[model samples]
Target: MCGIVGVVSHQPVNQLLYDALLLLQHRGQDAAGIATNHSSMFAMHKANGLVRDVFRTRNMRTLQGNSGIGHCRYPTAGSSSEEEAQPFYVNAPFGITLAHNGNLTNWEQLKEEMFKNDRRHINTDSDSEVLLNVLAHEIQKATVDISIDAETIFQAVTVLMRRVRGGYAAVAQIAGVGLLAFRDPYGIRPLCLGINETEQGNEYLIASESVALEGMGFRFVRDIAPGETVFIDNDKQLHTRQCADNPSLNPCVFEFVYLARPDSVIDGASVYSTRLKMGEYLAKKIQREGLADDIDVVMPIPDSSRPAAIQLALALGKEYREGFIKNRYIGRTFIMPGQAARKKSVRQKLNAIPDEFKDKVVLLVDDSIVRGTTSREIVQMARDSGAKKVIFASAAPPVIYPNVYGIDMPTRDELIAHGRTVEEVCREITADALVYQDIEALKQAISDVNPELTSFEASCFDGVYITGDVSREYLDKLENERNNPTKAAKPEDAGRSQLNLNLANEG
Candidate 1:
């Protein structure tokens, strides 16, 4: 849901954070922060906005240091203000600058427990801050100074593991020591390590995704496995520790469905390939479901659906056409946040060409439909373009449930498919008909890739939380809360922001 980076080198590495943030800006756009520790001195800066907007061109090199970490935040349990921003500095016996991606499921309970014991203070309601407190408390528990070496950090982290639950892909800088990185037991999120062969020596870099490493001119090493923590000390020694591991990998299926970048490979699967497979599967599913295949052409919604539409066209032996052109200047709807911004963005985000669909049966393919509004707008555009018939196809199933993880989808009323059938949804969106890829087919398409996974969090479609936060009982509680907003938990303090982020390892 966010991007995080860490670097440990012989020379200054603050620029590494800047470059890495540039690469990961697509992952999160709400806020950006960078922190560094050079010769035991810590410096940090965080603000609400895009990476470029938060850290100006001149300020990129401000936090000069050999050890550093950066975060592009997608708030899980935090506000869209600088107060909740990351790179949290907990000043005490020693300092730690930490940034994180992914949300913790048991945050509310943990915070209450922390208050019960008075072990830590809860501020801003950000899970990242809670995680920082956990690590800081763990460090304080140790007899040896954890700020000096990798072994001490590993030991501290192993102890901290006993206190927390849910997912985390974190990078932290410990003064006079080094940089540390780790992922949760389920390996629900991706983390990659790389090394830069520099004249000074070997500089190690870690990021949430491999693409960031490539962008930073670092050679990809390998993934940092779930339940494993890696520490790089001042001496540049890498120490490893294990907390727990659930070999049955059930990563969030939405990563391939729509969240991750096409060029990025998540859990060893090419995102582009998986998207194409969704198209191929949908093509066959349409045939099985006994739908008319008299479409003159297959059209993509543009950008994300380009590859998928091509695969669909090839499978159906229909011509592929670019029916819509996105306004590159319009930012993503989710990034804008709030309902008014989303509605406004939808109107300005896309444009349709009449020549492409005149008198033809246009089959529309898209990654996923968050709210039915955009699809409705696209349908109107298609009609205005003179398409005789517009058939909608979603590569993933209908989004009936709101995503609390980081996608900014909230409330059942916002989801047009929440209580409506697919047929009814088609009517609502003003489409002739709508066909979604079968859930099983979607699973096969993604799992067919290398390093197979048994299960994944697909709660967005089926309303089932396999891992991070919500349980069936909790889901019922949520439904109750949604029905009675007056009785619901305060939106600002709601822990539901996490969704089921790391549930694959719950068993």
Candidate 2:
């Protein structure tokens, strides 16, 4: 997954984009980039690092514009190369620059189609680049002028919706014309519109999460509807069109479980409340499974799981303790590129509090266990901290399938629960007892609080892709691509300790 932000304002947006990217840094840490349009002249600077490390005063000064877009990239569709960093730009179709959150399942086919049919050559393996070329091609077909009207822009988006299959929340700048943003038909990824009204005028921003908007002192407007296009002209006028006839609003359930920040609201559902309910539901499950009696203390695997762990301890009437202390400086181990890197980072990222675990029957709660690597390491850490017993509980149900929408898990073989029973997984992780929330219970926990969010894209747990196009063959192909050594040179693999890249010239 990635975080994308766009702004159309009266003043220079370099600092505004930078501040917004800081809020979204959690969504992606692999790479960051910013592209701004100054009188139809595009200036872009992209690097392979966190937002703070990537952009400096010199770089921000070079990115001079009132309207701009920024991106924090997590490599789901491309290799970790500086060439793959986005806000992908194209000189054609009026110098369009695009950034997006989520992955396209049909990226390979679209890339081939762009080469063969559109006569466009994609330089990088990044799917966002392909998406940009696709949009540029469609827009060019509609009109070859430097400026296109809202109707023509919407028409191009309609064609894009027909061609691209999978989840995407995209924002693009049409140099001399306007700023355009769109969501996929399934609404599998999050995107929202915000407005900041000042004496000068009203500034518009589109972000992957509502938190970024709220953080930048913008009024929270409603979410951009599924398959909807919003075009903001140079005059700051807003135009909207629902391109898809029958669009479903099934946002990814994993967003609530782990991906999104607790402070954010996604698709009208409060992420914090959903996680609290998940813990309450898991408490019931623990009681039902008769595992509540053996637990002496409920300990959280710091940060993301704290809210759920607090709620779980409250419901179970157990002592709540912060057993693991996370190092704030370390990046998230889950988003690390490779298993070896993730495993190595786990120890540096979190350390057990020996006083909390000593002589205690500890029930360790985490958001979810994907590969079991981190879970096993945490269990071993608790044991090494002198815990009498270590029980692992997950707020989410088992992740048995690959999440092809935006998340990095693209292969079934990498999942610990893909072909194993709960007992077998527990044994593998070396937990005294493993408790996972039920699939139906997880759905109920998230939906009970928000009636409007009736359904979700629970593909990882239920193995049901809402798009209804994912197949075994397609999954195998994705796995092969993920495992290809030549294409798998991640930033961490290159021994870059700071994880920073300066690709200003490449853009």
Candidate 3:
């Protein structure tokens, strides 16, 4: 997954985009980029680093524009290369730049079609670039004039909705025209619209999470509807059209379990409250199984599982302790690009406090266990720290299937629960006992918070792809890509680098 942001304002948006990217840094840490439109000319800069490292004062000064779009990239479709960093720009179709938050399952098919039918050559393996080329090609076909109108844009997006078959929350800048944003038909990813009204005028923002809107002094307007295309004219007029004939609003359940921040709300459901309910539900399960009697202390695996651990401890009448202390400087291990990187970062990211774990029968709570790599390491850390017994509890159900939407898990063999039973998994992780939230109970916990949300994309746990197109062959291809080493780009070939690329000068 990634984070995408678009802003159309009356003033220069360099700082606004920067500040918003900081809030979304958690969504992606592999790479960051921003593209701004100035007088029908595009200036773009991207690099392989966090937002703070990628953009500087000099770089921001060069990115002069009142309207811009930004992206924090997590590698799901392409290799972790600076060349794959987004907001991907195409000079054709009035200099369009696009950034997206989810993966396209039919990317290879679209790439071949673009090359054979549309005569467009994609330079990078990044799916966002392919998506941009698709949009530009469709927009060029639908437009009768130099400037694209709302009807033409909506029609192009509608065609796009049919062609792309995966989850996407995308934002694009149409140079002289304005900003455009759209969501996949399934609404499998999160996208929300917000507005900031000032004496100068009203500024519009589109983000993957509501927290970015709230952090940027923007009022949460509402979620952009499933399969909806939103267009903001240069005059700040907003036009919207439902592009999909039959759209379903099933946001990814993993977003509530771990992906999104607790402060954010998606589809009228609070992530914080959902996690709390998950803790309560898990607590009930612990009581039902009579495991709480042996768990002397409920300890959280710092940060993500704190809410659930707190509630679980309260429900079990056990002491809540912060056993693991995280190093704030380290990036999130879960979102790391490679398995080796993720494994290496886990130890650096967290350390167990001996005083808290010593002589205690600890019950550790985490969001979810994907591959059990980190869980095994964490369990070892607890033992080394002198815990008498270590019991692992997950707020989410076991991830048995590969997530095709945006998460990096692409192979079933990588999952610890793919063929192993609960006892086998417990033994593998070296924990005294392992317990996971029941799938039905998890659904109830999330839905009880907001009855309006009837469905969720829980493909990882339940192995049900909501898009209905993911096949065994497609999954095998994705797994091959994950296992193979990506061809690294040369330093000079890295797109744009820290310096701004002026598309006008290129032409």
lDDT of 2 by residue, 204-258 (tens): 9999999999999999898999999999999999999999867989989999999
Each candidate's number of clashing pairs is 4, 0, 0
- Segments in model 2 whose C-alpha atoms lie over 4 Å from true places: 144-147, 485-507
The full ranking of all candidates by lDDT, starting with the best, is 3, 2, 1
| Candidate 3 TM-score, C-alpha based | 0.95
Least accurate 10 contiguous residues by lDDT in model 2: 497-506
**Model 1, poorest ten-residue lDDT window?**
496-505
Clashing pairs in 1: 467-503, 468-500, 468-502, 468-503
TM-score of each: 0.91, 0.95, 0.95
- The C-alpha stretches of model 3 lying farther than 4 A from their native spots are 484-507
For each candidate, C-alpha RMSD in Å? Answer: 3.7, 7.1, 8.1
Q: How accurate is candidate 3 locally (lDDT)?
A: 0.90
